[model samples]
Every structure is written in C-alpha cells, then in structure tokens.
Target: MSVNIDLEITVTGPLDAEQAERIADALNDVAQDEGIQHDISFVVDEWEGRIEVVGGTEYPLIITRFGQWQPTFESRVHGAVQAVALAAKADIKWGYPDDED
Candidate 1:
C-alpha cells in the first residue's frame, strides 16, 4: 500500500519574489534532507492595495505533497519548516490538507 500525504504551511505576511524563492528553496532542501519525494508549490496572496493590520508575525504558505507517508512524517515536515523559519526570520503555520476538509 502506498501512503500519500499533503501538507500546507501558511505564512501570515507579505511575501516578495525573493522571499518566495527563498521559501521554495528551503522547502526543497528540507524534502531532500528528509529523503522525502515531494512536489511542493507556493501561493502568495495580494492584499489589493489594502493594508490590513495583522496582530502578529506574518509568514508565507508552503504546500507540499509526499509520494509516501511514514510514521515520523509530521515531525520531519515540522523540522523542515523550522529550519526555514529560523533562516528566514519568520513564523509558520502548517498542517495536513486532508485534516482541513
């Protein structure tokens, strides 16, 4: 049986092109280091010239799908995210997509 898992990481801030690229690179490195075969993508939302005040630190969202899931998958994912967050100086919110809906 093949186990597949989808992950979503939401970063709550404005992301520029460079920042997005950095995040993507970080995610790729994470996946590679963990021996996880994954397809990762990113989405950066535009606020439409409207400045909405967020009460806390903002981060970027990272979406990844794994070809196989293992028991320690979540921890591996978190570790990856943490490494990126620390390097980027950002906060992150993440979860499995299936758990959302």
Candidate 2:
C-alpha cells in the first residue's frame, strides 16, 4: 500500500537567505535519511520587517510526497525542523493529516 503525506512548515520571520537554505537542507536531510523520494518545493516572500495580519504572520514552506515511509519518519522530520528552527532563531508550525483522515 502507498501513503501520501502532505507537509507544511510555516516559519515566522524576517529570515535571511542563509537561514532559509538551512531549513531546507534540514528537511531534505530527513527525507534522505528516511529513504523516501520527495519532490520538495518552497514559497518565499520578501520580509517587510513587519508581520501581515492577513496571512497569520508567517512564511510557509511546503513539502509533499507519495510513497512508503518508515514508522518513525514523522518524528524524525519534526525533530529536524525543530533543530533548524532553534538555530535559525525562527518559529515553526507544521502539520500532516492523520492517517485515518
């Protein structure tokens, strides 16, 4: 059976280019370690030095994949994101749909 997981990571910032690359690298590492194939994509907007209320004050980076994954994959991904967030001094919000949903 195949499973498709849709993942989104929202970074609240004023992030510099280097910081953004670090986050992307961390997430990619997770995908590599899991031995899962992923087509990664990102959305970035110029930080205006102020949060915009219209979009909940965050920049979103999204990842999507359809394939088999190990049972511990999600946890590992979360940890990687968290570590990157801490180092980058940015806040992160992420989620994936429940398997049953």
Candidate 3:
C-alpha cells in the first residue's frame, strides 16, 4: 500500500524563484515527516497573496497567510488534508459536503 498526502495550499502574490523553493521545502519537510511523498504547488496571480514569516516573526503586509482543507471524493486526499491542517495553528477552511456553489 502506498501512502501519499495530497493537499492544496495557496501561496499567492508575486514570487521569485527563491521564495517558491522555500515554500516547496517547507511543505516537503512536513509531508516527509508524515510518511507522505508529495509536493505543494501554486499558480501565482497579481492580487493573490500569502503571509510569510521570516525568522519566525514579523509578517509583511505584502504577504498573505492562508490555510485550507477540502474533502474530496478520494480517501487519500482526506488523510493528507487532515494531516496538514493538524500541523498548523492558523484557521483552515474545510470544504463541505454541502458547500454553496
């Protein structure tokens, strides 16, 4: 049996190559610890932003912070999202079985 955790996390706003790599590293590190081999990817946009914490403190208004967990039809997706959500303190948005379209 293969265990893989696939979750969607958004890191928005203008990003340079370095910032993207760091984001990948952090997500990978978390996934590895949970026995999941997966990656975090983002599609950047002008207004989309993610809050960044450097040296563990001080956030730039330019950066935005977000955490979301959506339950899919797949069981594996559920596991991954749940695991990732548990690892963070920020509030997470969980998709509902009856989400308003």
Candidate 4:
C-alpha cells in the first residue's frame, strides 16, 4: 500500500493479567498462521517508531514492521489481530495517528 499506516494494538477496557495472556496466545497463533516475521512478543523499540500503551501494564501483542513495507503482510497482520481479538473475546484496537481507517 502506498499510504502510511501506524498499526498499534491496545486493550480497550480493564484487561486483567489472565485476559492479557489469552490475548497474547491468540495473537501468537494468528501471527504464526499469517507468517509474520518480526517478533511481536512485545514492543520492539528498535522498530522505526512505536506507540505507547496507555494506562495498564503494557500488553505484548504489538505488530511492528521490520523492513521494506509490505501491504499484504500488514494486511495479514491486521487480520491476525482481529482473529486474536475475536478468539480472546476482548476489545482490541489497532491503528494510530496516520491510519485513515
């Protein structure tokens, strides 16, 4: 995609430790299926940029772009995040300042 995107994931409400773990697991599973290369286990400060996780203990499922931007890869990652949110039954949102949608 030619457009710039800021893809960051954050929990919507009060996310307890247990729920966070489930979200992590779900994200991992979906990421694996989507063939994501970067380590989304946590916030990779080395990425070009990162969005801060607001109020709570930072949750791990962050998907950061590593190299040349690939729209299909990012699209799959977004889809994976959506899948994780559905599986965990949690309210998760992805996208940042530059995102149009």
The top-ranked prediction according to TM-score is 2
TM-score of each: 0.38, 0.44, 0.33, 0.37
Per-model lDDT: 0.43, 0.45, 0.33, 0.40
Model 3 residue 56 CA deviation in Å: 25
Candidate 4 lowest-lDDT run of ten: 50-59
Please list the residue runs of candidate 4 whose C-alpha ends up more than 4 Å from where it truly belongs after superposition: 1-6, 37-39, 42-101
Q: Over the stretch 4-78, how does candidate 1's per-residue lDDT look in tens digits?
A: 343344443444555555555665555566544244444443366522111111322233343234435555544
List the candidate 3 regions with Cα displacement exceeding 4 Å.
Answer: 1-6, 38-101
Per-prediction CA RMSD (Å):
8.7, 7.7, 13.6, 10.1
Spell out the clash pairs found in candidate 3. Answer: 13-48, 50-63, 50-64, 51-64, 51-65
Best candidate per lDDT, number?
2
lDDT of 1 at 42: 42
Candidate 1, which segments miss by more than 4 Å at Cα? 1-4, 39-101
